[model samples]
Target: MKNRPFRERMGFALEGIRTGWRREASFRTQTMLAGCALLALLVLRPAPIWWGLVAVTCALVLALELLNSAMEAVIDLLHPGIHPSIKIAKDMLAGAVLTISAAALVVGVAMVVATGPAFLAEIGL
Candidate 1:
């Protein structure tokens, strides 16, 4: 697989994204929320640095989510049984995803708070 062409590798990644969108509710939800954050950034026109910060946070969340989903799938395929070690591993994966998600939320909130006056003025509030 490593020897495959770059095009093939990108196609595989796209397929994985499609699978996540179709099979994982959390992935779909996070993707939508991330889209909203990006939309907010577009509308608000915050600082240039903020664009990078927000984009990175959103990408981190989706990437972590995909990693979490891929690992859980592997665990299920290999074990398919209840075990303490597997449970802890799964819990840690969940915790990691949750931590990044929370960080993304904080970055989003900070962006809004920093742009509050401009946002309000634009919205006629």
Candidate 2:
């Protein structure tokens, strides 16, 4: 098949995002959580470094989840029957997402705790 133009590729990506949002429960949940985190950061106005860290980490976590989901879908499509190799591939992709998420959580918590006192002072709490 001929490669799609840039615009067409973008349209395909947009469609995938819409479908994922509608069909994937995990994607929806993570999106909601990310939105809440963004709201909190906006309201609190954390330090520049902390804000950057949070934003990048959140994006990385979401991206990893999306990649893992896509990998699982492709693996299932290619191997519908139960196969140990397929199972291992899926498991490894899932593990990658889990590891990234855990790391993101730790970074987020550490940033919050490290800057909590300053944030409270800013808000006169």
Best by lDDT: 1
lDDT of 1 at 38: 84
Reference-based TM-score of each model: 0.94, 0.87
Per-residue CA lDDT of model 2 for 1-125, tens digit only, reads 46989899999888877877887787788788778778777876778987888788788877877777888888888889999899889889878878877887887788778878888998799
Q: For candidate 2, report its TM-score.
A: 0.87
lDDT of each: 0.95, 0.81
- Which ten-residue region of model 2 has the weakest summed lDDT? 37-46
| CA shift of 4, model 2, Å | 3.4
